[model samples]
Target: MNKNEDSVKNSEFGFGESNDAYAKYFFGQSYLKRLASNSDEKINVSNVSFEPGCRNNWHEHSIAQILIAVAGEGWYQAEGQVAQKMLPGDVVIVPAHTKHWHGADKDSWFAHLAIMVGDAKTDWYESVDEAEYEKLN
Candidate 1:
Protein backbone atom coordinates (compact mmCIF):
# COMPACT_ATOMS: atom_id res chain seq x y z
CA MET A 1 0.00 0.00 0.00
CA ASN A 2 1.07 3.61 -0.58
CA LYS A 3 2.26 5.81 2.31
CA ASN A 4 -0.87 8.01 2.26
CA GLU A 5 -3.10 4.97 2.22
CA ASP A 6 -1.16 3.46 5.11
CA SER A 7 -1.49 6.67 7.11
CA VAL A 8 -5.23 6.66 6.67
CA LYS A 9 -5.46 3.03 7.60
CA ASN A 10 -3.40 3.53 10.74
CA SER A 11 -5.48 6.47 11.87
CA GLU A 12 -8.63 4.55 11.27
CA PHE A 13 -7.31 1.56 13.16
CA GLY A 14 -7.27 1.43 16.94
CA PHE A 15 -5.11 0.04 19.68
CA GLY A 16 -6.62 -2.77 21.71
CA GLU A 17 -6.90 -2.69 25.51
CA SER A 18 -3.58 -2.70 27.36
CA ASN A 19 -1.87 -1.41 30.50
CA ASP A 20 1.55 -1.06 32.16
CA ALA A 21 3.23 -1.29 35.55
CA TYR A 22 1.99 1.64 37.61
CA ALA A 23 5.25 3.26 38.84
CA LYS A 24 5.39 3.41 42.61
CA TYR A 25 6.75 6.42 44.52
CA PHE A 26 6.43 8.40 47.72
CA PHE A 27 4.25 10.93 45.98
CA GLY A 28 2.50 7.97 44.42
CA GLN A 29 2.88 6.00 41.18
CA SER A 30 2.63 6.72 37.49
CA TYR A 31 2.29 4.64 34.34
CA LEU A 32 2.91 6.11 30.95
CA LYS A 33 0.44 4.44 28.64
CA ARG A 34 1.78 5.80 25.35
CA LEU A 35 2.35 8.89 23.29
CA ALA A 36 -0.87 10.15 21.71
CA SER A 37 0.44 11.43 18.40
CA ASN A 38 1.74 8.99 15.86
CA SER A 39 3.29 11.53 13.48
CA ASP A 40 4.11 14.98 14.93
CA GLU A 41 1.49 16.57 17.19
CA LYS A 42 2.37 16.97 20.84
CA ILE A 43 -0.02 14.83 22.88
CA ASN A 44 0.57 12.60 25.90
CA VAL A 45 -1.33 9.94 27.90
CA SER A 46 -0.33 8.96 31.41
CA ASN A 47 -1.87 7.24 34.40
CA VAL A 48 -0.90 8.94 37.67
CA SER A 49 -1.15 7.76 41.24
CA PHE A 50 -1.22 10.02 44.27
CA GLU A 51 -0.63 8.20 47.49
CA PRO A 52 -1.78 9.43 50.85
CA GLY A 53 0.02 12.72 51.54
CA CYS A 54 1.30 12.84 47.98
CA ARG A 55 1.00 15.91 45.80
CA ASN A 56 2.65 17.64 42.84
CA ASN A 57 4.36 20.99 42.57
CA TRP A 58 2.22 23.89 41.43
CA HIS A 59 2.87 24.37 37.74
CA GLU A 60 1.52 25.99 34.59
CA HIS A 61 1.11 24.66 31.08
CA SER A 62 1.97 26.08 27.70
CA ILE A 63 -1.02 24.25 26.33
CA ALA A 64 -4.11 22.78 27.92
CA GLN A 65 -4.58 19.54 29.85
CA ILE A 66 -7.37 17.11 30.63
CA LEU A 67 -7.50 15.02 33.79
CA ILE A 68 -9.87 12.12 34.19
CA ALA A 69 -10.10 10.48 37.56
CA VAL A 70 -10.20 6.75 37.02
CA ALA A 71 -10.19 5.58 40.61
CA GLY A 72 -9.97 6.81 44.21
CA GLU A 73 -10.14 10.48 45.15
CA GLY A 74 -8.20 13.73 45.21
CA TRP A 75 -8.42 17.49 44.72
CA TYR A 76 -7.38 20.05 42.10
CA GLN A 77 -6.86 23.75 42.39
CA ALA A 78 -5.83 26.54 40.06
CA GLU A 79 -3.91 29.69 40.82
CA GLY A 80 -5.64 32.24 43.02
CA GLN A 81 -8.56 29.88 43.53
CA VAL A 82 -10.02 27.32 45.88
CA ALA A 83 -9.45 23.61 45.37
CA GLN A 84 -12.20 21.33 44.21
CA LYS A 85 -12.64 17.86 45.62
CA MET A 86 -12.47 15.17 42.95
CA LEU A 87 -13.78 11.63 42.91
CA PRO A 88 -13.99 8.73 40.57
CA GLY A 89 -15.46 9.61 37.16
CA ASP A 90 -14.65 13.29 37.63
CA VAL A 91 -12.93 15.20 34.86
CA VAL A 92 -10.92 18.36 35.12
CA ILE A 93 -9.90 20.60 32.26
CA VAL A 94 -7.06 22.96 33.00
CA PRO A 95 -6.43 25.89 30.71
CA ALA A 96 -3.00 26.86 29.47
CA HIS A 97 -0.87 28.93 31.87
CA THR A 98 -3.22 28.23 34.76
CA LYS A 99 -1.14 27.23 37.74
CA HIS A 100 -2.53 24.23 39.57
CA TRP A 101 -1.74 21.23 41.75
CA HIS A 102 -3.45 17.91 42.47
CA GLY A 103 -2.96 14.88 44.69
CA ALA A 104 -4.49 12.34 47.02
CA ASP A 105 -5.76 13.08 50.50
CA LYS A 106 -3.64 12.71 53.58
CA ASP A 107 -5.11 9.26 54.13
CA SER A 108 -6.43 8.11 50.80
CA TRP A 109 -5.21 6.82 47.45
CA PHE A 110 -6.06 8.49 44.18
CA ALA A 111 -5.49 7.66 40.53
CA HIS A 112 -6.20 9.51 37.30
CA LEU A 113 -5.42 9.54 33.62
CA ALA A 114 -4.06 12.82 32.27
CA ILE A 115 -3.66 14.03 28.72
CA MET A 116 -1.74 17.12 27.62
CA VAL A 117 -1.61 18.93 24.32
CA GLY A 118 0.82 21.50 22.93
CA ASP A 119 4.56 22.02 23.52
CA ALA A 120 5.65 18.87 25.33
CA LYS A 121 8.00 20.52 27.81
CA THR A 122 6.22 21.13 31.13
CA ASP A 123 7.29 24.14 33.17
CA TRP A 124 7.61 23.20 36.81
CA TYR A 125 7.30 25.46 39.86
CA GLU A 126 7.36 25.42 43.64
CA SER A 127 5.54 22.79 45.67
CA VAL A 128 2.11 23.69 46.96
CA ASP A 129 2.44 25.50 50.22
CA GLU A 130 1.13 23.54 53.18
CA ALA A 131 -0.79 26.55 54.49
CA GLU A 132 -2.44 27.17 51.15
CA TYR A 133 -3.25 23.52 50.68
CA GLU A 134 -4.84 23.28 54.09
CA LYS A 135 -7.12 26.13 53.23
CA LEU A 136 -8.32 24.27 50.14
CA ASN A 137 -8.99 20.96 51.80
Candidate 2:
Protein backbone atom coordinates (compact mmCIF):
# COMPACT_ATOMS: atom_id res chain seq x y z
CA MET A 1 0.00 0.00 0.00
CA ASN A 2 1.03 3.58 -0.54
CA LYS A 3 2.10 5.80 2.34
CA ASN A 4 -1.29 7.47 2.49
CA GLU A 5 -3.22 4.23 2.68
CA ASP A 6 -0.79 2.71 5.16
CA SER A 7 -0.97 5.71 7.40
CA VAL A 8 -4.73 5.62 7.47
CA LYS A 9 -4.73 1.95 8.31
CA ASN A 10 -2.39 2.55 11.24
CA SER A 11 -3.82 5.82 12.40
CA GLU A 12 -3.33 6.70 16.08
CA PHE A 13 -6.73 8.21 16.62
CA GLY A 14 -9.44 6.18 15.01
CA PHE A 15 -10.73 7.73 11.84
CA GLY A 16 -14.33 8.66 12.35
CA GLU A 17 -17.05 8.41 9.75
CA SER A 18 -17.13 10.62 6.71
CA ASN A 19 -17.61 14.27 7.48
CA ASP A 20 -20.62 14.63 5.28
CA ALA A 21 -21.91 17.72 6.96
CA TYR A 22 -18.84 19.75 5.96
CA ALA A 23 -18.03 17.86 2.79
CA LYS A 24 -18.90 20.90 0.74
CA TYR A 25 -15.98 22.76 2.32
CA PHE A 26 -13.39 20.12 1.59
CA PHE A 27 -11.58 18.91 -1.49
CA GLY A 28 -11.43 15.23 -0.60
CA GLN A 29 -12.78 12.97 2.12
CA SER A 30 -12.44 14.02 5.75
CA TYR A 31 -13.62 12.57 9.05
CA LEU A 32 -14.60 13.98 12.42
CA LYS A 33 -14.68 12.49 15.91
CA ARG A 34 -15.86 14.62 18.74
CA LEU A 35 -13.47 14.28 21.66
CA ALA A 36 -15.22 16.64 23.97
CA SER A 37 -18.10 19.06 24.05
CA ASN A 38 -19.77 20.94 26.85
CA SER A 39 -22.41 23.48 25.97
CA ASP A 40 -22.44 24.89 29.46
CA GLU A 41 -18.68 25.36 29.48
CA LYS A 42 -18.57 26.48 25.84
CA ILE A 43 -15.83 24.01 25.09
CA ASN A 44 -15.46 21.99 21.92
CA VAL A 45 -12.80 19.60 20.78
CA SER A 46 -12.66 17.13 17.92
CA ASN A 47 -10.28 14.85 16.17
CA VAL A 48 -10.28 15.49 12.44
CA SER A 49 -8.71 13.17 9.95
CA PHE A 50 -7.99 13.73 6.29
CA GLU A 51 -7.34 11.42 3.43
CA PRO A 52 -4.44 11.99 1.08
CA GLY A 53 -4.76 15.25 -0.82
CA CYS A 54 -7.74 16.31 1.24
CA ARG A 55 -8.01 19.90 2.39
CA ASN A 56 -10.59 22.25 3.73
CA ASN A 57 -11.43 25.51 2.02
CA TRP A 58 -10.11 28.82 3.22
CA HIS A 59 -11.93 29.70 6.40
CA GLU A 60 -11.78 31.60 9.66
CA HIS A 61 -13.29 31.42 13.09
CA SER A 62 -15.02 34.18 14.99
CA ILE A 63 -12.76 33.32 17.94
CA ALA A 64 -9.25 31.94 17.91
CA GLN A 65 -8.79 28.28 17.08
CA ILE A 66 -6.01 25.85 17.94
CA LEU A 67 -4.73 22.83 16.07
CA ILE A 68 -2.48 20.15 17.47
CA ALA A 69 -1.10 17.78 14.94
CA VAL A 70 -1.56 14.28 16.22
CA ALA A 71 -0.64 11.94 13.41
CA GLY A 72 1.08 11.52 10.04
CA GLU A 73 1.57 14.69 7.97
CA GLY A 74 -0.38 17.71 6.82
CA TRP A 75 -0.21 21.32 5.69
CA TYR A 76 -1.53 24.52 7.14
CA GLN A 77 -1.58 27.85 5.37
CA ALA A 78 -3.01 31.25 6.02
CA GLU A 79 -3.85 33.82 3.40
CA GLY A 80 -0.69 35.37 1.95
CA GLN A 81 1.65 33.01 3.78
CA VAL A 82 3.55 29.89 2.85
CA ALA A 83 2.00 26.61 3.92
CA GLN A 84 3.37 25.13 7.12
CA LYS A 85 4.15 21.46 7.27
CA MET A 86 2.56 19.71 10.23
CA LEU A 87 3.79 16.63 12.07
CA PRO A 88 2.99 14.99 15.35
CA GLY A 89 3.32 17.40 18.32
CA ASP A 90 3.25 20.51 16.13
CA VAL A 91 0.89 23.15 17.39
CA VAL A 92 -0.68 25.99 15.46
CA ILE A 93 -2.35 28.93 17.08
CA VAL A 94 -4.56 30.65 14.59
CA PRO A 95 -5.73 34.09 15.50
CA ALA A 96 -9.36 34.95 15.18
CA HIS A 97 -10.50 35.88 11.68
CA THR A 98 -7.35 34.62 10.01
CA LYS A 99 -8.23 33.21 6.63
CA HIS A 100 -6.59 29.82 6.43
CA TRP A 101 -6.91 26.26 5.21
CA HIS A 102 -5.40 22.94 6.35
CA GLY A 103 -5.43 19.22 5.56
CA ALA A 104 -3.47 16.14 4.66
CA ASP A 105 -0.39 16.20 2.51
CA LYS A 106 -0.50 14.68 -0.95
CA ASP A 107 0.89 11.35 0.15
CA SER A 108 -0.07 10.89 3.77
CA TRP A 109 -3.01 10.49 6.05
CA PHE A 110 -3.23 13.13 8.77
CA ALA A 111 -5.16 13.87 11.93
CA HIS A 112 -5.31 16.77 14.35
CA LEU A 113 -7.07 17.86 17.47
CA ALA A 114 -9.22 20.89 16.79
CA ILE A 115 -9.95 22.96 19.85
CA MET A 116 -12.41 25.75 19.54
CA VAL A 117 -11.37 28.26 22.16
CA GLY A 118 -14.76 29.82 22.51
CA ASP A 119 -18.13 29.71 20.81
CA ALA A 120 -16.42 30.08 17.49
CA LYS A 121 -18.49 30.58 14.39
CA THR A 122 -16.49 29.45 11.40
CA ASP A 123 -16.83 31.24 8.09
CA TRP A 124 -15.64 29.19 5.18
CA TYR A 125 -14.44 30.68 1.94
CA GLU A 126 -13.31 29.38 -1.46
CA SER A 127 -11.31 26.20 -1.80
CA VAL A 128 -7.53 26.44 -2.08
CA ASP A 129 -6.62 27.10 -5.67
CA GLU A 130 -5.47 23.89 -7.32
CA ALA A 131 -2.53 25.57 -8.96
CA GLU A 132 -1.29 26.96 -5.69
CA TYR A 133 -1.74 23.72 -3.80
CA GLU A 134 0.09 21.74 -6.44
CA LYS A 135 3.11 23.93 -5.93
CA LEU A 136 3.72 22.42 -2.50
CA ASN A 137 6.24 19.62 -2.11
* Candidate that scores best on lDDT: 2
Which ranges in model 2 have alpha carbons more than 4 Å from their true place? 4-12
Q: Candidate 2, residue 90: CA error in Å?
A: 0.6
Residues 38-86 of candidate 1 have per-residue lDDT tens digits of 3366667766655455677787778889998765667888988778887
Q: Give per-model TM-scores.
A: 0.71, 0.94
In the range 1-137, model 2's lDDT, one tens digit per residue, is: 55656555456666778999999999999999888899988999888999889999999999988999988789999899999999988999999999999999988888898998567799989999999888888
Task: Judge candidate 2 against the unseen true structure and give its global Cα lDDT, from 0 to 1.
Answer: 0.89
Which residues of candidate 1, in runs, are more than 4 Å off? 1-39
Candidate 1 Cα lDDT to native: 0.63
lDDT score, candidate 2, position 14: 66
